[model samples]
Target: MSFRMIAQERPGNPWFSWDYVQGNSDTILAALREHAALTAQAVLIATVVAIPLAVLAYWVRPLTGPILALSGALYTIPSLALFAFIAPYLGTGTSTVLVGLVVYALLLIIRNTLAGLNQVPPEVRDAARGMGYGRLAQLLRIELPLALPGILTGVRLATVSTVALTTVGVLVGHGGLGQLILGGFRNNFFRAEIMTGTLLCVLLALVLDLLLAGAERLLTPWSRRRAEAG
Candidate 1:
């Protein structure tokens, strides 16, 4: 029922046992690898799909309502139910997890993308047009670069969220840190496994978030300059 060992004279109770961890390095490490891969894969797919939807939502007035509404609705779906619904069609496994994670990310990515684009000063677009830039040229040259911070912000959030949700994805046979947590629960809350999975999940999210933020800072030198000045 428990993975902890309590010595009669040592302590009243132990939260987790390091000795158990020593024997389970393979399982823990393997789950960590799978968890990282699953999270990264989901984020990449979501970004690819969300970018165009975000652009459409920004440029096309009529489609904005439907686009945002669709993404928002999808975001509201229970992750487990969505995974279950798609597993039958996707036939389970990684494909099903990918579809579910991508759909869940859409609302965040699309909304942030639109906000980023909208934040671009109207004068900047006007000036680009004044300089003989076409709509596409304006978007490519003036808007997208400026909007990187916001788009990347969404990407950061979606990536971290995907990591957390991957634990749920274990239901349909997608292995990750979540699988470890599920295993712990099945084994009457095995403390070492549960703690390892939980800590690894947090560690992974923090590392990924910092990496994204670092990338954003590198790409947006102007923001860094502003920070330095103020």
Candidate 2:
């Protein structure tokens, strides 16, 4: 059958009519919302879990080697296998997707968070101590502030990676922009729908990266001011 004939409105299947177009658009919107929600949830959970572990590892020194090794191993699990392994417990949906994403994000965020924290100059820490700043005070007022830019940079990277991986959820029956690409493939429609999904994902990543970059600059106004001065 011709493309038009195949895509054209049929009597009983609701996908063809103008009403269906509007509804499908709504469905896509809902899917996008779900995708964002799951991705964010995973990232936030992973960030909370990983950053502290990273901080502790950095502080402990003895545990650093083991922790890094563990994270690296987790990172090696192929996305598809990770999702499939979780399928029995989490089943097919956002939960499994979130779990896989959280695992994937841990190594990245933790490493970045550690690097950002460690980047604070030792002299600065000594100065803070000399000025009677306690550990908590030093971390809150000095170290974390200095680290914020790099932490935000890691977040931007994590978000973009999650967005791309969410597309893979289609394989395990989760829906998102991936559904668009899957539908296109199943229908043998070359690249039209696939391209649409790909472009949307890329654009979403770019926008997220820009927003995170802005947040970094906003949070580090002193750096920006110093740059202006120089």
Which numbered prediction scores highest in lDDT against the true structure?
1
Best by TM-score: 1
- lDDT for each residue of candidate 2 in 12-96, tens digit (9 for 90 to 100): 4332245434656775666677667877787889888987887788778998889989999999999999998998988786788
**Would you estimate the TM-scores of all the predictions?**
0.91, 0.86
Worst 10 residues of 1 by lDDT: 1-10
- For candidate 2, the per-residue lDDT at 147 reads 80
Candidate 1: where are CA atoms >4 Å away?
1-14
Per-candidate clashes, comma-separated = 0, 0
22 in model 2: Cα distance from truth in Å?
5.7
46 Cα displacement, candidate 1 (Å): 0.8
Q: List the residue pairs that clash in candidate 2.
A: none
lDDT of 1 at 202: 92
Error of 1 at 102 (Å): 0.9
